[model samples]
Target: MNTNSNLNYTQTGDYLLPNLTLNQPRKPLGKYGRLRRTYLKEQRPVLYHTMLLNGSLYPHLMEVEQTAENRMQQTMAQLLKQNPVPDKEQNQMAWVQHMNSLKAQAEELVLNELIYS
Candidate 1:
């Protein structure tokens, strides 16, 4: 009901979701195969947070957050396994970029669920 609160925490007493459209990656994923799987897996916590904030505490909703976190952890593990970094020379910038990208994607996915639900 309060659009200003949804847009900014200072007005709503809650943190506004990240703006993904304004900071999308230069190289978008060509397909949504991996993305969809990750999203579906991670939809749990996001749902939980949304429900919690909305004043409806559903025990079942907690599973959404747990499941999503598990899926994301597993995905990150797989990615790290597939791409090993050198010991002496680390790509700090690349690591930062990747982390930021993942964070943005997660936030976007959660925000999308909240907005739609």
Candidate 2:
């Protein structure tokens, strides 16, 4: 009986898989990103290029959205505290409508601020 009868050999490269990380921040530009960035820099040197290079544009928008959400939650909590809804089943529709209105107003305020700023 051969001692190496159960021994097997395979190519390691055949089973290789790419290591991917979920939390990795992607490059802002993908295909043709460099060209687009260059074009923006050349055409709109002061406003677009400066904001893009400083990384201020997206962060500012994110901050605005967060502010709007926070304000909406605070306003909704205050309104609910002031006007307690005793009957959940009876006022369910009205409560939803009121909350939606408040949310729309908050969003509008954020948009106006962004537009005028």
Candidate 3:
């Protein structure tokens, strides 16, 4: 029983796999992730401030934002469905204004219902 024969080897190339093992716990996010999280928290303090106040709320904030986004998307979809836009160059300006109004209202609603509350 040649046990060595069972093992396969390959020539080393320009790329080499890092000596990482599945048993070893993976490292946390890098600087960029941290920075992005910080930025997002700052942008929506009402929602994300809880993370700073209570570290455990970090995951909760993510869930809150996800739910808020889903609600906004649903509302926007329903509005557009109910009020179909005319696909003409003359109606382009009106379409844009309508979209902007919907977006602003959605933002306010999200902030009030999800974030501030």
Candidate 4:
């Protein structure tokens, strides 16, 4: 019996291949996860390969994405609190522009801290 954590491997000739079963359900990667995946692949290939070989790449990426999302939300909330938006009905365009800028600022911070770092 050859196994590693939740995965099982079967030997055929001299090679071993993982036998993945459908009992476990995994969520598909989201926007942040995809971005982090690309960054790891392009910028940190060796670390990415190490995690991939150890069957930890997906989980790690998912964790990073979750953290990034949580951080982004928190940052957005803080930004909103610090600089509250004006009335939406009276000045719809200005409100939209302000909200967009705030969101962009939060996104930049999350990307810099979690994805790029």
Overall lDDT per candidate, in order of appearance: 0.48, 0.52, 0.60, 0.86
Model 1 TM-score, 2 decimals: 0.35
Which residue runs of candidate 1 sit more than 4 Å off their true CA positions? 1-57, 86-90, 102-117
Positional deviation of residue 103's Cα in model 3 after best superposition, in angstroms: 1.5
Per-residue CA lDDT of model 1 for 1-117, tens digit only, reads 235434432333575453322322334332232344344446656754564455443332343455555655665666667665444346777777776666566655643553223
Candidate with top TM-score is 4
lDDT of 2 by residue, 2-112 (tens): 234453444457653333223222434332234334544676568654665556644544445456557657766766677664465788888777767766665566445
Candidate 4 C-alpha lDDT tens digits along 20-91: 633221888888888998999999999988878767888888898899889988998999999999999999
Best by lDDT: 4
**Cα lDDT tens digits for candidate 3, 1-117:** 123454334435864333322221134543333444565577866655555554544455456656777878987887778877666588888878888887777767766676654
On a 0 to 100 scale, what is the lDDT of residue 85 in model 4?
95
Cα deviation of 61, candidate 3, in Å: 1.2
How do these models rank on lDDT, best leading?
4, 3, 2, 1
TM-score of 3: 0.50
Q: Least accurate stretch of 10 residues (summed lDDT) in model 4?
A: 16-25
TM per prediction: 0.35, 0.44, 0.50, 0.80
- Between 2 and 3, whose lDDT is larger? 3
Candidate 4's C-alpha runs over 4 A off are 1-25
